[model samples]
Target: MAREKKYREAVNWKKELRLFPGYLILLIWISFTFVLLGWVLLASFSTTKEIFSNKLLASGLHFENYVKAWINSDVAGIFRNSLVYSIIACSLLIVICAPAAYVLSRFIFPGNKLIQTGFVSAMGVPVVMIVLPLFGIVANLGILNHVLSNGMLLIFLYIGINIPYTTIFLMTFFGNLSRAFEEAAAIDGCPPTKTFWLIMLPMAQPGIITVTIFNFINIWNEYFISLIFANSDQLRPIAVGLYSMINSMKYTGDWAGMFAAVVIVFLPTFILYIFLSEKIIAGVTGGGVKG
Candidate 1:
């Protein structure tokens, strides 16, 4: 009995030792992250005077900064623009990418492998390399200087850029699915379109959700492309809008307001991640598992 107890204790010690590094790393990461976020939160409530005086760390919390940001700053308009762009771009991406991915996954055709390889290769090409050509095309189309025109152009650009990756990801996901189900549908006299829509689509939900979430986040957070394309304040997404706000600080000196704007910019994506994290995880895991 004593020897058995000693063996159990040895196993417990080994387990504890194994966990120690992970615990330490987690603790360190959490501590640093909390400190950084806490600093930003505190800064949002602090006045310029408090910041310059180095008294921001000691100042009492001021909740009114958020109200000022929402009411007086360009943040409200920026938020609206971002929401609109993200919704449109994400919806269009999913609609286009889903059907395309579904076709690519199930169909066998001449040049299919070549097309797939082309897409995968395109993924490695930097956006900057194509930006000038894209700009020239939009300019030739007479849309570069207009806000709504440029916004729509950017949406199309995002769709094109993201499609390759989304297609490949969904192809891999759909490829792993069993042929038995599709075969059964065909034997039941179901048409190809009907089989895809009613059977394969339902099964591919996880992959669809995963791709949509990724695209939504990427488009929402995108700054450089929006900046290059969008020429007006009204068209600027939150990312570029926030940068403009900070740049305007030289003249306005609205540090507190900028911080509040930052918080507002961060809120939507944060809320989305919190809510959709479970769905994203499930989608990725389901796609990874083979039948």
Candidate 2:
């Protein structure tokens, strides 16, 4: 027994040794990411000259950098715009996708598979291919800069673009849900739609929150479509506004302020991941666990 235990210990050691290289690579990657983020945080408080001179933190923490980035650089308005876009887009996405996904997962209708295939295939199509035609449609509709109308248009664009991904994500979650709940609801005289709304959706909360966080982050940082549709400074989201700031950095030379803006733009997603990462993991794994 002692000899057999020794042999098994040796075998486990060899398996760990085999994985050492992968472990080393992951450690290096994580170290690099931390170092990069640390540098950005340090730079956000340092002066541009100090940053360029490799003297990070020499300026002794300049809070004014954030002020300049937020007010002088006009990031506050852009941040608000991004907030509006993300909120409306995510809300509309759930309203539209949840039911559609539940139906697709639960019901058998004509062309259902075709619709599913179309949504999956749409995910692969490049945005550049559709942007130009979409631009033309928006232009011909004569609703370019009408503030509220344009805002709604941008929200619609966000919903339209993200619908495929959200639908597919929710479809998997709904498909994994047990039909026992639905049968129970039916026995209680609940209608199909009510059963879905009251029963399935509550059970799918993890997936919905996971997908909402994803869509919020995506729409908040989205640039290309927003750039094409919302070119005006007042309508620009953080992504587009940041690009403009970078362009003007040549004249402004406020690298510290730029880094501050970057941090501000990145904070929401970072905090979200820090808090809800477990929910995200649960959502992705919950479907697979049952199957």
Candidate 3:
């Protein structure tokens, strides 16, 4: 009886320990994330006076700062530019990357492995390394130093940069799909193109949606490329626009306005993540886990 009780007690203790570690880790992570986010939120409502005085926690919130930032500053225009560029880039990425991934995943050819290897290699190249060459190319094309040029060139650049990862992810999804469906469709007199469009593409919806969301976020948040290529205030995205606002602090001394600008810049991505987070998670996790 004593030996049996001891074994049962030990097992219960182990189970309790397992629960404690997981809970502790989760609590720590949650606390860290919340603390960081809380700082940003607090800063967004604080003025330069509050910040410099080191009494931000005791200062009153300045909600009017958002209005001034939005209407008076160039923040609205910047957001518009970001929206336009991101929309164009994401749309092109979806149209081009989807079909390419499907073909690459489905077809067997002499250079198939070589093509895939090249894509994987491209993924390893850092954005900083590519930026200089891209700038030179844009300059050679005589579109450098123009805002519209920046927006137009960035669409193509973002698409190209994101394509490798998008293709690889969709390739895994496409490859895991059963061949039986395509074979059956072919046996029913469907052409390869028709089979791909009518059958396979619909089934790949989850992966496509997931990739599109990722592309959207990437294009929306991209700063380095836009900063390098775009020169004018009208063509600046939120990232560049926010930087400009902060820089203007030297002249205007409006810390509240800058904080408001930060909040405005952060809103779109936060709202998007809040609404589509479940779908994004499901789409990514569901793709090809079986195969």
Best by lDDT: 2
Counted clashes in each candidate structure: 0, 0, 0
TM-score of each: 0.86, 0.89, 0.82
Top-down TM-score ranking: 2, 1, 3
Count steric clashes of candidate 2: 0
lDDT of 2 by residue, 106-200 (tens): 99999999999988888888899899988898888876858777778889999999998899888998998999999998999999988888889
Estimate, for each residue in 1-291, the C-alpha lDDT of model 1 and write its tens digit.
999999999999999899999999999999998888776778888887786776884678777788888777768888888888778877787677777777887889988888888888887887889899888888898996777788788778777778787777788778878999989999999998889878887897777778778777878888878888887778888899888787886578878777878888888878888899887667556543211
Candidate 2 Cα misplacement greater than 4 A, ranges:
1-20, 281-291
The sequence of per-residue lDDT tens digits that candidate 3 reaches over residues 101-183 is 88999899888889888888887877788888877878888885675666677677778888887887788878889999999
In model 3, the Cα lDDT at residue 52 comes to 74
Error of 3 at 65 (Å): 1.2
Instruction: List the global CA lDDT of all models.
Output: 0.80, 0.87, 0.79
Cα error of candidate 3 at position 167, Å? 0.9
Q: lDDT of model 2 at residue 46?
A: 91
How close is each model in CA RMSD to the real structure? 3.8, 3.7, 4.8
Candidate 1 segments exceeding 4 Å error:
1-14, 17-22, 51-61, 278-291
